[model samples]
Target: MGDYASQHSFRIAIVGGGISGLYCALAIHHHCTKAAVSFKVDVYEQAPEFKEIGAGIGLRPDAAQLIHNVGLGDGLTAIAGGSGDMLYRRFDDGGEIVTVPLSREGSVKLAPCARSELLELLKGGIESRGAATLHTGKACQRVEGLGDSVRIHFTDSTTADADLLIGSDGIHSQVRRQFVSDNATFSGFIAYRGVVPMKSLPQWPLPSYSVAWLAKHRHFLVFSISSNEALNIVAFVTKEESQVVHTKESWTSTCSRGEVFKDFEGFHPSVQDVIKLMPEEVSRWRINDHEPLDRWHYLDGKVVLLGDAAHAMTPHLGAGGSVGIADG
Candidate 1:
């Protein structure tokens, strides 16, 4: 056990195939190749395949550089659009409170991409390597430590042992529970997120930038993606209108357009116009975050938590995923 190269190849089990999990797997694979180490890594995803439903992801300089280093720069460049200026506007009147250029000195501009596209880019990278295997529909039930190694129990009555267990399973992570015993609490906010085609909103002129419409107890984020073929929208509001809804068991829930309209009646006409373009059925997710954990690993560092499982912060700062990529 002391000499990894002298013995059999090291085994790494990654639970969850989301952004953080795949990114971690790729990062680990890259490191293993560079260090000339013998290792086998596998990713266990509960879903049948890698799928993500969200508005868009704004990749700052730090995240962009990380993705570039992971050897996905060409894919990212092909799928994502660059956001020139970001605007914070008044929700009631569409007045700009601030205008900030997203590009930093000696760095690439901020890239806004459809979340699903980014996931595919990552999934492709992992699949292309042939060094990692992805197991789908295998939900992780619990994890146990056996001396120097860890055993992960799946709901399908299967088990896997690994020298290292990386938990990128989002906020309701089973790995976090086994290690930290922390609970995630709702923050009295729910996000109504969706995306629409740019052609549908021909009357509305959208800038080549990201815009945030803010009002009392609510905000809307809009940006371009897929080569400006569509616009992603995220509407945030208090949980008052969602009293009858419970999102603890599952973060995402489907709701009618009327429900969204009730909560977004006071927004500016421009904002409302964008909301009107959404599909008849919409999905809303509860905003939940956990208290900071004292530690992120267990079983003598054999198991660890990353991404939202470690620090599920508010999306206002847009650093949650960025921080997780860094951890990977």
Candidate 2:
């Protein structure tokens, strides 16, 4: 912010190319173009190609508004699904316990979008504007602050320098380590997630509304995505923190359908029916979150953290992605 008006160009380096990273890149371009500030953005991703590794993501009203403000309203509307009430039901008998409205009158309703679709929208936004240079397969190994600039060293022995560095990397962020001492801790919760074709569940009685079948130590969330063509299912179970031997490397793995059934035994028959329709191989995720840090920036504002890298909480509220969008 210091005398950028006189500068011919400003450089930004983003260490990750996930949802927040791509959205941050697009937002920067939108603002800089409006303020007449010339800037260059470079995004480095560790994966061989840009891809989102999840099923569905919920965009709260505020996050949807931010995307609209960033000039991607049309694209968002194209991919976003209708809003619905969230019904909580007893797991044993499937009796309704409560209904929570997910949309407020005169406000943008909560949007259900496939994670991959949203990622594509963000990538298309950047591509349409030609706003930033994207480098794939370049994992950030470490970072060094050089007075007025930051230098990023990647695993491939490549390096890049920029006036500022932003870390939109997910929960396991390399840049966040430069400042914070604490790492992401296992939340003692594991989730089995997968999508089932609606055609397979023709007898599915639930409406298009989001549903949460709850029990003492477990819960199963079911919502429609992909224009109601599929049902996105996430079944969570609590286990002793010490009992589960997991690492970041084993954060996500594929498990057999029987594993999910064993954890969710004795659930309502309707719930079991939905579970039976899940793909033979379901994704097992070891849920993790951070113990909020006192600070998220370093090198006197030259480096910053956003999204899950900044505050990775449980997905109970479905605000993780939305909050990350706001962080941008």
Candidate 3:
């Protein structure tokens, strides 16, 4: 996009179709001309649909700026609730921990929203610009790099050859597996997430601000995703190791109230209140992460990796999605 003009008329084929793929396509489309890019920016995903399968994400200042840079600034803010004035409390005794007000000026930028909602927003924005094409359900089984182009083989028996390929797939990316052979480092803790409707609230004590439960071996995080929706709660606990251990939480794992209560019985009553308000159908997953990589792009010709595929990180700081947004 700077001095050298693209070799083709299209933007070329893109490999993944989640938030990262969409953003990458838009960023490339923004900087390069229709002629500067290649033939088509085709995004390949393992899923049949583009909907978000997971929960919510926290948007930081850098993340918001990434959204705004891709021209989704207005819509992104419109869908998310204000978390700038969020208050925090330790449910151990329902005692207040600290109240950090973001509402003063730049606080809203640090808030979060449902992952599905934000992905939908990013998809709409990317398509609105008429820059890229997406191919879902066509998982990339393997990618072969040609000096001047690339060929991608899919599990669905279909194959496509293109100029550039971007692997925006998530942490379990097959594309990344071919490149990086290391395994995901386990974080000792697990997160239980669920959304409780306000109508179910006996007496809503959740601060206008997001709250966190810093219990002994367990902690819970509470915040609202939107004004009209239920509150999103995430409970974290140490995963007790067992000789016959098997994973109960995954990309899609649902749990029950009994299981949750068994984990957090030692916390405060108010914490109990929050847990009691939660539905029996809660979700859980062990926190896993990747080591930081020196570079994201593996430009053997026109192939590169983006987002978590390139550098998956821990979610303790709640920057998982933000990092993906930034990479795009």
Candidate 4:
């Protein structure tokens, strides 16, 4: 097997139409193309449409370098500001904290990319490469090991059989659900996140970086997500609002600015002023965490977990998205 003339030809079945799934297909495709080997890749997503949400991602130089290595530089650079900076402020007063110039530390290319923008760019690139198939609205119901091949059954009444089955479905992954009874964990606090147009902030310059505001009640985050996008804002507070949240499986939902402003009363009026500008509720989620499992691989001879499906976190370090992109 070590000295065979024919390289191993791969047929990959990726479950989940999220970034990790798409990225996996892309990676496999690029590798086979480089090796001049034949392979097929397909991704299954449960959504009717893959609409990128209001979340903003913070990427370190290492993460950006990884994207470049995958030959996604142009697409990454398109919706991402690789030359951005990082700014900080006090949560209460909105007073200026020390500003840190990111991306100046050697070959680091950092930027805040809107989750939607990143998805659009990544999906577009995947299609342009002609290396993978994305089947949106097709949810993976089951993955069964069938000797040398794996069988993938979907809710859409279709199935795919491939040499390798990948479960990159995400935190509440059905693949994970089938593999283990207890995996996901609750991290104990909920996050209220939203974005306001720059036009909403007349006192600020076109923000050239990301900012973190720390207060007693909760910590707030603001950053410029993309060139044409709004200024991103997120607040992580310890409230019993989890009981008030609408959905059970979902982590986030939309809320009015008044709801969020109530928590930051003693802080700065500038903060409340900013809140008043928001038109409506965006998204909120009660954060959670899980202990790393001994076995990420499962199902006799097939299936593997990726992204939050594998490792969920509280995201206190601003590296959650960075880590996810790095995992990709």
Candidate 5:
């Protein structure tokens, strides 16, 4: 063992409870157990419980393999909506333009999962290990480094110390601000996302296919999630046509149904029908991305950044969350 490994017990503090944080804890626990290293891990989340607000996410081959390696393959597969080819369609008439397969022969298969369901699986995996403890409703206000250890201050007038800290917080991460002194840049685009019952749209295409429609400057994506029980929909619009006000107060804002319909007035009838089914209230958030940092660690490598806090990307590739899973 190295000099740092000579400590009585190594402690790791994870600053977020999202996919990245929970998965990181599981990874560290499994790795240290395999090496017979004595260590303690804790995950601090601001929310009351583990949850994901987004509609759906696609896990690439690498991510799936990582999950399997972490002993979550069976649990994840149980709720996974099997993956297939992605189709690109014309926006005006919903005509198929091209099809792209997401998996190859004799290779790790791609999987699509509801964000919340995946979170639940990760939470269960960590709990089953009986190693790390989760601290909820503990918002990290600031973090400080003291020679060989780091101390984190929370809003509840409490603090915790650790040998190392990992910031898996999201784009608006408080940890990233203190450690990296950086902020996420607005991508000049916004997305409207939500999920609806698959039964509500009986005339739609088969639930197995994931579809994307490309217009001049906007696009719409639809896919099945929750074992084909619900359909997830996302529509992107440029900043020009849809002006986003109140730039800094909050990222998400509620809009009326009429507003959404007006944005897609010239869209295809099929697209129009889907938009109409959307509830009266919808939430829109500004898309933000950042350039890759040359370095992601601080305080003599005692702190690190992961996921959106480190390298946020546009959703056009649909691999943002998967990238974080890979990092774990």
Candidate 6:
């Protein structure tokens, strides 16, 4: 047996219990068990409880297949909504642009699901496998390398040591800051997102397929989630970098419906109607991404980065979450 195989027990500490963190835990457990290695994983989150902030995410076929390969296929199938071609149209005249099929013959279908629901599914997978111990309300303040092991210092003044530390935290990752000198850069884009009940849009024109309305410097995307009971709408607008007021506060904020309406003024009536149907307030998110790093691990691979912490990108293709899942 190799030296690693002969080790008595391997300890892993995962910072941030979001989708990437939890999914990484499951992946580690799956691989360790297959290799007949004894391991323990600890997942730490800054939130008081496990919750996802986003509305919905569309997982590409490969990401869905990754979940299936990780043994959560049944759980994902239960919560996943339908998938088909993505229809594109012009925002002004509502002219059809093109239809892009998300899946080819014999390929797995796209999986659109609520972010919260996907988190629940991943948490359930962790629970069923007894893969990791979840720690909430424990924010990571910093990390220290101890040559042979890594020590994590939390905001509560507590500490934990593990053989390996994985940072799956989102874009503003504390772990990444510990080693990498660079930070996330604003992508010159902002997105306003909301969910509207399907029942409210009785005269909805498009089919159930995901749709995008294109225009100069902006686009609107809509797709069914929660079993087609609700539509997730995202309005993306390009903004001058100087117009953005970047802060340490939460990246997501609520904006008045008037602001959204003003942004989409002169759009087609169908697009305007959908905007009107949205709630009085919606979430505005400033999109940010990072330049590719020369490496994802440090301290001889004892410390590593995953998901957005490693490679954050604009959600133009709805591949961000799926990329995170693949990182796991």
Whole-model lDDT per candidate = 0.82, 0.85, 0.71, 0.70, 0.81, 0.85
**Model 3 lDDT tens row, 75-175:** 87776755545566665676777777665464337647777888888788767877677667898898887656667899888888776677887777777
Worst 10 residues of 6 by lDDT: 243-252
lDDT (0-100) at residue 282 of candidate 5? Answer: 79
The TM-score between candidate 3 and the true structure equals 0.88
- By lDDT rank, best first, the candidates go 6, 2, 1, 5, 3, 4
Clashes of each: 0, 0, 12, 9, 0, 0
Candidate 3 CA-lDDT value: 0.71
Error of 1 at 109 (Å): 2.5
Better of 1 and 6 by lDDT: 6
**Model 1 clashing residue pairs (backbone):** none
Q: Report the lDDT tens digits of candidate 5 across residue range 1-328.
A: 2356476678899999998888889999889999998989999999887878757777887888889999998887777774667888888877779888876887767777788998999999999877589999999999999788889999998999888889998888888889566677778787888788778985866334588889876888888777767778888888842477643323257688787788788888877878888888876767877877888889888888888777778888888888988887
TM-score of each: 0.93, 0.94, 0.88, 0.88, 0.92, 0.94
Which parts of model 2 have CA positions greater than 4 angstroms off? 1-5, 246-252
lDDT of 2 by residue, 1-328 (tens): 4455247479999989998899999999999899988899999999999898668887888999999998887778777765578889999898989988777777766777888989999998999889899999999989998887889999999899888899988899999987777888889888888877767885757654488999988999988777767678888889787755742324267778998899999999988898888878778888898998788889999999999999999988889899989988
Runs with alpha carbons beyond 4 Å of true place in candidate 5: 1-5, 103-106, 206-208, 246-252
lDDT of each residue in 1-328, candidate 6, tens digit only:
2254257578899999988899999999999899978888999999999998658888988899999989888778777775667889999888889988776777667888888899999998899879999999989999998878889999999999888899998899999999988978888888888878778985867764488888898888888887777788888999887866742224357777898889888888888988889878777888887898889999889999999899888999788789988998
- RMSD of every prediction: 2.1, 1.9, 3.0, 3.1, 2.3, 2.1
Cα lDDT of model 6 overall?
0.85
Clash pairs, model 4 backbone: 52-116, 92-268, 187-288, 251-285, 252-284, 253-283, 253-284, 254-282, 255-281
Compute the lDDT for candidate 1: 0.82
Sum up the clashes in candidate 4: 9
